[model samples]
Target: MTSPHSKLHISRSLNRFQTQITIFLPRVAVSKMTVVHIVLIKFRPGVAQEHKDTVIQELNKMKEMDCVKHHRLVVGTSITVPVERSKGFEIALVSFHENAIELDKYRNSEEHLRITTTHIYPHQEESIRFDFEVAPEEEHLWTFLPIPAEN
Candidate 1:
């Protein structure tokens, strides 16, 4: 039979072990807030249809990235104004990851590099990227633009 003192000691050890386990387990706490990233991509002018298709296909794959909270791709139409006329960037906007870290991951992602090098660079006459940080209040504004449907 175990002595009372020994039993008490064993109980203490088990409690400590349980506490350690609880402390180390990953928590699922939600982020109180998030950052926003507005990415503007200018593709090379006069890019071939095949190249554009490939780039779009690669960009569409970004939706599958774990770090991407939201993703949207917009092509510049005649109504859109170029940020720089000399460079001739056909506008494209990519919205992803509300966190800067996640955005960094996205920038360094293999898929992103692959798309740029394989499809964008080969067909692009010139390309540029712009990144903007957005506040919580301004988040909805990005999606608030009015556009008429084309026939």
Candidate 2:
């Protein structure tokens, strides 16, 4: 859902061809509208370091895909932050797409399927994913809440 606080506006401009065909979107939603995908993964016991490295390498390729607007992979850094519960997951993947269509493209892409099925899933014991839409300036608000499969 889009933010009620946001507004959509359209404007027209002349191009070099002197044609009157231009659409200008709202600065807030158009510039900041995004769908976010966050995945938390826990590797099974005794999973080798090489396997984990392969996951990171493969996940990095998602960033190079056209559908992804931004991507980041990070390892859990703290066990002492008592207020923050991670469910013992060790790795996280964060990605953003311009909209749901772009996100769906990324989800079904061959590059994603190849890595997760071949490299990462075999080593993981459990995984959690959260997908949400974030409107401009609504960082504290989430569109949906659930713990689902990372795929």
Find the candidate with the highest lDDT and give its number: 2
lDDT of 1: 0.55
- Candidate 2 residue spans exceeding 4 A from truth: 1-32, 70-84, 137-151
In order, the Cα lDDT scores of the candidates are 0.55, 0.68
**Global lDDT of model 2:** 0.68
lDDT string, candidate 2, 1-151, tens digits:
7634533232322233322324343444333568888888888999987878778777877788888874433334225466347666877888878787678668766677677778778888998889888876785463345659898
What is residue 70's positional error in candidate 2, in angstroms?
5.2
* Candidate 1 structure quality by residue, lDDT tens digits, 1-151: 7333311111112222532111222334434344454444455555666666666666777777777765543443223445355344453646557566577667666666666666666766655566656667766776655668999
TM-score for candidate 1:
0.55
**How does residue 91 of candidate 2 score in lDDT?**
75
Clashing residue pairs, backbone N/CA/C < 3 A, model 2: none
Clashing residue pairs in all predictions, respectively, total 2, 0
